[model samples]
Target: MFHNFLVTTEHRDFLRFLWHEDNDISKPLIDYHMNVHVFGNSPSPAVATYGLRKAVEKAETDVQDFIYRNFYVDDGLISCRTSEEAVDLLVRTQRILHDNGKLRLHKFSSNNREVLDSFPQSELAKDLCNLDLCNDTLPMHRSLGLSWDIETDRFTFCTCKDKKPFTRRGILSVINGLYDPLGFAVPVVLKGKLLMKEILSSTNSLDWDDPVPELFKKPWDVWVQSLTELEQVCIPRQYSDHSYTDSNVRLVHVFCDASKDAIGAVAYLQLFRPAGPEPTLSFLLGKGKLAPNGGSTIPRMELCAAVLGVEVADIIKEQLGIPSECFRFYTDSQIVLGYLTNTTRRFYVYVSNRVKRIHSASSPRQWTHVATEQNPADLATRSVSATQLSNSMWLTGPPCEILTKTLPEPLSCFPLVEPQNDCEIRPEVTCIKVQMDDVKPVNHKIGSERFLRFSTWESLVRGIKILKQFIYTFLKQSDIDSSEAY
Candidate 1:
């Protein structure tokens, strides 16, 4: 694939290499430059991708769209409803890339035996090349990190036996090695993450290569041993047997919850078929994140989980092309439900910002309350073993009761805020103005004569000065009256 694109003359300088000719050390080293993008070159992927897209510029709309959306570097993955459609798409894509860019598109694998029969065995994946499609069962193939079981058409997990030191780095490597982009194993993997967090946060700081504390050793070993059970866990690749567009009603339910140790959200696709007696429910995605350090209230943690639920729901909605109105959000915590459904109450900064995010993507009418035991996201916020995860409702989807039950009356029916104490609720403060009756000023003569009216020394002095002024005015007027009488 990389050899299909020729490197420009100016850029070939960066691809120059020194080589010894004919294994003769006596001879001077020969400098050679690569004319084409080669493997191991950093720019090869981008260059090849651009070249591939450029080659298919005038191809069929479907082919162009598939190339643009499905191709990851060299490999292209897509799903089709019918075996014929799959075969046709692969054939056309292969022919277009080969005719235009001289690129070979091969090693194709599909769950349908008919689809494989349409292509030559030489072009099939290495595992399928020698197999007799008629006599043998299809084998498991790894696609984009996830193990694909073509026989069952389901995605499965396999654990690697690579042993590493039980140090911080080793533990982290084991945790990161599990590539679950769809979050199928998030709950199980979350246990390992929490364990690593505990080890790193020990009172004494430990280096990457340093051994973890002895106290955490047993739990770490237990987690490592549990990986073997992951092979038992498998999820359907296709959401439902029937196409969602054919269904009578399609709904997306997202459940979010939080625990002291973690917070998380899980989404499921519910398809109501017109003819089928019961609706089909499938797990779409699951996400588990550790709670913020320094402690957080359950309500706040639950709020974080709600935000995560909205994000997960958005992704599922966009991928599934489901309408936002058909999506509903569930939370076990009434506080979170209140936060999402709140219309009149103002919240503190933390709750306000998160509430705004939830409201922006979803409406108050879309959120409703669910009992704790019924919430599938509960598995995400807490630790669960591989066995539990394989059998947990988190994978199989929400409980049967939830699947059949009607959605509660819109957010209007639910209480806006809890009657009891809630920390997230911002206290409402009111300012009231009182109009006191007017108090008339005291007459100077009356105030001076009544010494008891003056409480403080300053008031008494003020009253005395007022009395002296009054006496001087009266005396001046009396002198005039006396002189006139004489």
Candidate 2:
């Protein structure tokens, strides 16, 4: 792809490099000029992308938006409703790029055998080039670094079997090694994160090489064994059967929940079909995080989870091209719903900052309440084995009651409690100031007039000392005058 773009004449000099012929010391070094962008060149990626974009703009094709949105640098990933549409779009894109910029768009692979058969064998991915589509079973392929089984059209996980010592470094390596970028494995991985946090905190002399405490050994072993079960779990790559062209009402439901240990949020894409009574719910994405250190209250944690839910919703909305109005947020906590719906009451800084963030991305009307049992995000706040997750609603989605056209009566509008009762609320403080009729204004140089000018603590302290001295002198002088008058 980088080879497709020719470097401008003036810039070729900067890309020049020294080369040796056949690695023979007998020959002198030869200077070469790079006429085309090469791998590792600083501007090569941008040049290639810009060339593709320019080609897309000039080409008369329907896949312009597809290329722009789906292409990550050179790899193009897209999904179509039918094999025919997929083939047509890809072929047109290939032709346009080839004719316009001499760019070859190849290595195409698809879940549909018809789509694969449409392309030339050479154009297909290397693994598919030699396989007989009719005789051989479809093999699993890596899409953007995730294992995708083309035969099943599902995403699968594989555990790294490499062995390591039972030490902090090894534990960390194992934790990060399982790369579920979409957070499909978050609930399972979250337990590991909480364990690591505990190991790091409770063990004072813990070094990278030091083994975890004996009490944690069994738990670590159990967690490691559970990873093998992840291979059994498979998630559908495609969200729904119907495409964007279908007359279906699309909605995104984001559920958030928190426990003592962690906070979690999950978003699902729901489609209300005209024929089907129940809406189809597909897992979009999920996120789980260990609660921050130094301790936090349940209400505060719930607020944090709400913020996370909004964040997940925003990402889904942006990627899916869905509008904000189509999104609905769910939380099991009345306190959190109260915080979001509260209009008259002000909150303390911790709650205020998070509430403001939630409000920025979503409005209060978009949020509703769900019972603890129905909130799928509950699975994320605590530990769940791979087997449990495979069957759990965390991946399957929430109960139908929550997705109905008319949501359960918004949890009784829980009135925002008084600030004094809730620490999260900022209590209204009143200050009384008395003015003396005979007292003159403070000195502009050293009194409250100069307080705002001090930018640092030291300067402010010094200014306050000067102001105190001035006030003492003025009061003493007034007393002396009163005595003389008497």
Candidate 3:
């Protein structure tokens, strides 16, 4: 059930004239203060969305649960094990949206003939299947942009053959044509994205539909041809069948890895069956990011991958409706592991912020090391042909044999490294300040500014202290050498 919630006057508290909309060119010239402030796919709709969801919290039990879990920014999506349950959910959900959230539920759809029969066709959105209307006809519905066959209960793709030339616009048309929001096609699609990057970065002024350089022309055409076969690749809509639901021993394992060209993460539901076999896994979702033009080193990229894993894991945790303890994150980089495990080691701002976010979603104990060879996210960082992605275990999990092997887990607490000698200088020189008699030591102001680098006066005093210490140490060493000579 997808619905629209009115952004009410309650959100406009002292926020009136501050919001304005430009007049349509053909319409009146006066600037109009817009009442609906949450338009244009803006982020502010979240504030109103939360209020509506919260309002529905105490409604009928099933409706409350549906409102809590299924709604995303006002669009509600849910699946039921049975048509009877669907009817109950549908009716209750409709009432809760209207009565409590003051929302109107519309655009309803389902494969079950009985479920659709209950609602007036006026209340339902037109089916995209382009098929004749009937009680028994199953239509193709788009759930969150992935093509879903209501009859088959599998995920499908809507593809169009690109007859356009091998130009910038043509390449973009074909690449953008792929609608794999769950990233099932990413390994295949990334090849095209990287190719597009090459073409765009090659010449800033290239016309949108102009012919590409001879180099990319062949590869671009080949990739476009491969896109049609993507429709042949269908995934089960649900991660696991209801009859085959995972036991409580299931864990959400998120794998992160990076290459110089890209970083990616893939999540899976690892289900441990009681039959004494290796834990099986079902692919939940995957994410990928191209390396920025301002290049980042491999370790930093790996850290970026780890941060991405945390975000993906946290999201899957919420969506899975599972206990938070059941979430685990894996990364192949020892550098990232050290950063995550070390409580005492301070890092540069970039690393620090990422580590903080990772720690926020997962405990240090939940982070485990996985061998690069065993990391499935490696496929995400590198390119894979459509055929390879379809057959390979990367989208799922590592093979069963690899999963059976035990990893030598790193210790949770990293021991702080001692200084080079008996010097009092800090391990992190940039972060620590040298203690000195401040002309007014005990009476220093409460909010005095701290400096990462020394000022001129402090530098002079610091230089003198270093020199004095060096001279004294040299004289002592000379005396010791003279005594040995005598």
Query: lDDT of each prediction vs. the true structure?
Result: 0.84, 0.85, 0.72
What is the C-alpha lDDT profile of model 2 across 208-304, one tens digit per residue?
A: 8988779888888889888999999999998877555573689889999999899999998888778866667888999999998866988889999
TM-score of 3: 0.73
Cα lDDT for residue 246, candidate 3: 39
Model 2 residue 399 CA deviation (Å) reads: 1.1
**Global Cα RMSD, each model:** 9.8, 6.0, 8.5
Model 2 misplaced regions, further than 4 Å: 6-22, 25-44, 202-215, 275-277, 405-412, 429-486
In the range 1-486, model 1's lDDT, one tens digit per residue, is: 898899899989999999776668888899888999899988889998999999899999999988998889988889888898888888898999989989899998999999999989999999999999999999999998899999999998988898989788898899888989999998899999998888877825778888776888898899999988999888889998878668989888889999989988988888888878688888888889998676588778888899999999888776767878988888877777767766777887998999899988888777777888888889887768998887798898877687556475566666656634777677776868854333743331243346777789899889779866876787777765532332
Query: Which residue pairs overlap in candidate 2's backbone?
Result: none
Candidate 3 overall Cα lDDT vs. reference? 0.72
Model 1, residue 357: C-alpha shift (Å): 1.7
Residue pairs whose backbone atoms clash in candidate 3: none
User: Between the candidate structures 1 and 3, which one is better when assessed by TM-score?
Assistant: 1
